[model samples]
Target: MKKWLLNILQCIQDIYQILKEIKALYNQFTIVTAHLQTIIRLIENYNHLAEEREKTVDTDQHQREIKLLDIGQVMKILNISESTYYRWVENGELQPRKKGKRHYYYLFDLQDQIAKCKLKGRL
Candidate 1:
């Protein structure tokens, strides 16, 4: 009877250890899921911005002259966030013309970027 009780206790300890490991794995999975959700949101935002940009480009393509646009105007025209624009500029994917405290982007370059991103399946 004493030996049987000891064996049951040992089994219980093993089960407890297994449960702890499962809990740890579950926590890691939760963290990964959150990161995946964030990435998905970012992708959706980019696709929406690309769609908006395509519409604007289609309308503006007929014009021979490209316009220099400020941050606010570019954001509105591209339907992208200020942070994304800044990040793109920092990554050298986009360029800005700085004049004192003001920055401007050329519409033609933005359109070209949109086309490249689309070709890369980024949009």
Candidate 2:
């Protein structure tokens, strides 16, 4: 009878240890799940921002297709570097419109710059 009780007590202790391990695993799983949820939320927010940007770009493109030139377009048209562009802006040679964080120039302004360059024998 004594031996049988000792065996039972050992079995109970083993079960308790297994329960503690299970509890630890559950806590870890919960933490992982929370992190995954946060990641999912961040991705969703990024996607939403991307979609909004696409819509804004599409609208701007449609409205300013031929009238407005972005920095890259202006650079390509003038064959100038970014530093030169900013220098021109600083010198009051080129006036650009600001929308959000981007700068846009009018097609007429670019034509004027080109004519000035030709007159100065720079182009």
What TM-score fits each model? 0.50, 0.53
lDDT of 1 by residue, 46-78 (tens): 999999999887867744266678889877766
* Model 2 lDDT tens row, 4-121: 9999999999999999999999999999999999999999999999999999788766666667789999887787799999999999888889999789987766777888777877
Model 1 CA deviation exceeding 4 Å by range: 62-123
Q: Of the candidates shown, which would achieve the greatest lDDT relative to the real structure?
A: 2
Which runs of model 2 end up more than 4 angstroms from their true locations?
66-123
For residue 97, give model 2's deviation from the true position in Å.
8.9
lDDT score at residue 13, model 2, on the 0-100 scale: 100
Candidate 1 global CA lDDT score: 0.83
Alpha carbon lDDT of each predicted model: 0.83, 0.87
Worst 10 residues of 1 by lDDT: 59-68
